[model samples]
Target chain A: MTTPTSRPDPRPAVTMSVGRDKHSHYSYRDFFRFNREQGTIIDWNNTQNLLLSEDFIVGLQTGLEREVGDASAAVMYTIGIDWGKRDAAHFSQWYEREYGVGVKQSNLLFLLETWWWPFTAQGWGKWEVETESKQKGFLFINLFDSMVARTLGDVGKPVCHLYAGLFAGFFTTMTSKELSCIEIQCYAMGETYCKFLLGGQERIDAANFWISEGASAREIARRLHQE
Target chain B: MNSMFAELLQNAEGRYLHPDELESLRAYVEGIPKRVRIYQVLHSKESVLLDRVMEKFQPTLPHLTRRHGILAWERCRRDLGMVWRYCCMAMLLNDEDYLRDKLLYWLETILKSFKMRDECRPAYKLMLDSLASIFTAEESEIIRPYLLLAKTMLVG
Candidate 1:
């Protein structure tokens, strides 16, 4: 009826004007369902959830440390990796169902924000993801109020190995690449928040060496940028 | 509209909201008429608004166009489009912190990282001023604070 006045649309049109619910795509209220009468907690993806106490979460680490000694970090990390990989499948499923977009097709940063919101909603923490360096084969995640680190507090070393493992495992499964994550800085180490470096195995190896040599997150970032 | 009503009922803990929390619900309802109008206007007239912004922008910041080439207009339009969308979303949600936490923080980092800050800061102000032509004072009041909120976060 009329000449097309604009260039080809760069993105999906804003469909909110056409009777979409303000929260149709999602909302915190709808993301999780709690049935007090039935004593059940179910998420949008129909996954069952457990409510954990801070005492239990802290005791979890102490108990692990008591049982396995210094290897507790590795044990926690292994659990995180497995947990993350499992979540990836669940993430991909609901992600497709909710948005009608495949994981790979959407912009990674946007997809990542969507992915992390559930974690944030579940009280894991709020996080900022840096992808400006993604083209250089790696990225950084800054996590505030890490459930593990916040509860453990000021132990003077990277105490978020589970977080690092979770990141590594999630990305590895999502990308189908052998990616790994290293805790470059942590709140428990007297930093304000935790910082993680996610990349391929080679990069993770280099970071492992650097950490052993006492390099800071900033130092590790600089070296990675140089490479 | 249903979401707001649903929100009036459902909460994270499977419990009803306190009467005090409904204060925000009430505000969201009051702003709905203006928010819906602004959202429709922004959606339908996106290109026109972008062109109007460019009309002022190209003449004022001639150096950026030359430095960046013709593609800069595309990038500028996309940036302004994104900014306004965030503004509209924040207005609709009636959550004052939505724009800052969701978009401006990310936008600021990208602009600064690419050395686009000095040039882009003025555009944000221009973006706000360009809306004066269409939005009435009543509509402007609904939108202005958010645009300024964005400007406060990014321009400064």
Candidate 2:
């Protein structure tokens, strides 16, 4: 989990030749304002039990318990921030401080890039990372329909729903012990969450769930039940 | 005349007849002059052309002689390329198990026939690409292992 001083290139090296949609540009600030107006932020924060409600947490805990069996404790953390040039770097720093124990440099960097920018900006992508430890444990996960608004150039209430469901799924499954810290980098309108995990059996298990064939949010829950 | 015809038909019934038998049959039928009667006789029976070819070039497993089976298989493949291509297309469209099996059988035959020929490379590539495109995510999972085998054979 020792954070590297130099940041790796966040973008894919190969250039894709797909054409972009010609329409209006949706800023992060606009997205955030719309979410606030629709009470998405409140629901996300659980201010009045509207967002990130107790029930969601219970369901998540239930799933985790099924997967890991009896756990000593479980906790959930929310991270958010505004748009800035140094946001990614700052997030990386916080992640290292939170989850740096026994995490490999390559895996940490790959996780940061995959979660922070690609998943946040592009809507969907997959990441696979292996620890540098003697056992070389690995983690894999994919985000789907997360960047629909950005990629498809359309935004409204539907985008918020997709984002909330995906992030909520992530938040519910991950534990404080499994993750060192949660970082939220804010933009003009919206924010991205980056979760860092301290290498543990649970984290590896979660990673396996992510890459397993035919895995989805529902499938992961079924797997947790079977376990 | 009926007995003569019966003798001729009985003579050609089974076994690999000489190539001259085919030519003589055609000539004898043409001499009948009555087109409808000739059509009735020929249409009533299956053409033994395929059987004759099969008899001439016996296809054996493990391909006893390298040149014999391989060369015969090549001729059959070239003759049946159109049929194989159609089978490949059908498999892509319907995703039928039987069609896919047939396509693979033909591909293997072609590959074995032209072991190191240039045609093998493109044919294998086309088959792989078609499989990748045609199969759904779930079906692809089942088909991927075979695809990998074909890929290794093409490469090695």
Candidate 3:
């Protein structure tokens, strides 16, 4: 009989290391800092901080309602679209600096997430973006824990118009094509998460009409799918 | 690595320093023990420190979120985490030029894009409070100057 012999394990054991060799994972922390003495917030590159309060955000919404009435949503949406354009420009520069590659050269999902990281850090909720229909000039976004609607409770109607406008604006800038968005579902409507559909003006208009006729989100999705 | 560091620093000044000058500065900061100690403590306590800081901000998060939106508050939380990490690395390098470069580069971009200066105060105070609660007197003494330096640069 052949004698059996034990062999040393060939696989390397996994161990965490704290050493100079490992590159520190870059995070939002790498980008900014705050000073208490001067009551200022500055980025790591030493620029002044621009900040706002929750009161300002809500007040913007309410103040618009008082001034422009029903036209407020359109104004907010228009503002978001413009903001998105500026953000795209800023993001292009920032991304190039941080990663040594232009934003245009990055992978789509990576680019979107990187673009949204600041908003997330700035106190928007976490989100998931669906670009499955990007080639068709449309996309879907689901936002969990939406700040705008989180405290608004179940008012039974979509209450995240600002986010909808933001998506519409940001995407329009990113794609260099006019896109609009509508919140088909919202946390204020007693949903677990808010859902938004963004596409060209024609598609959004159809969705809006269907929505006015009381179409369910699923029905709207199916209808938009056919379009 | 040396070239990259020099390039980043030069980018900050908008002009390149002489190669010899960059090398001298790099060599000077190479392995100071106090710097290493600060890095070790910061890295070791990072998660614990973050949790404490978050707890300190807990009561205010709802108010902040209600006003700014969840997206903004989320960003604020994340930025606080990053601030701690940056402070640690900045302290370890002990290179003022490097710190200034990183500060100017990041701040310029953030400030240009978003109006978020007001959010910094609470976060800074909470971070200092968290650090005080955790660090021993000797440890705090060693790390305090570096922390303050980072805070000043950030504010400046």
Q: Rate the local accuracy (lDDT) of all candidates.
A: 0.76, 0.34, 0.66
lDDT of 1 by residue, B1-156 (tens): 344455566663577667777787687689788778777876677677777777777777767767777788788887788788878788776655567655665566445445576777777777788777866666667778888888877767
What DockQ does each candidate score versus the true complex, computed on alpha carbons?
Answer: 0.15, 0.00, 0.02
Interface Cα RMSD of candidate 1: 7.1
Report lDDT (Cα) of residue B103, candidate 3.
Answer: 48
Q: Lowest-lDDT window of 10 residues in candidate 1 chain B?
A: B1-10
By lDDT, the better pick of 1 and 3 is: 1
Minimum summed lDDT over a 10-residue window in model 2 chain A is located at A180-189
Off by over 4 Å in 1: A1-27, A132-137, B1-127, B131-139, B150-156
- Top model number, TM-score: 1
lDDT of 2 by residue, B1-156 (tens): 223345567887877666776786666566444434433432332123223433334433335346444575556445334333323333233233333233333344334333443434444344445543444454444434444454444333
TM-scores across all candidates? 0.65, 0.18, 0.52
What global local distance difference test value does model 3 have? Answer: 0.66
Clashes of each: 0, 12, 40
Off by over 4 Å in 3: A1-31, A43-53, B1-156
Best by lDDT: 1
Please provide, for model 3 over A1-227, each residue's C-alpha lDDT reduced to its tens digit, 9 standing for 90 to 100. 01111322111221222322212212344433455655655442233445766676678777988999988878876776666666676677766776788777766776776677566555578788877777777888989888778755677888788788778777777777878899888888888999999988888888889989989888988876786
For every candidate, how close is chain A to the native chain A in TM-score?
Answer: 0.86, 0.20, 0.79
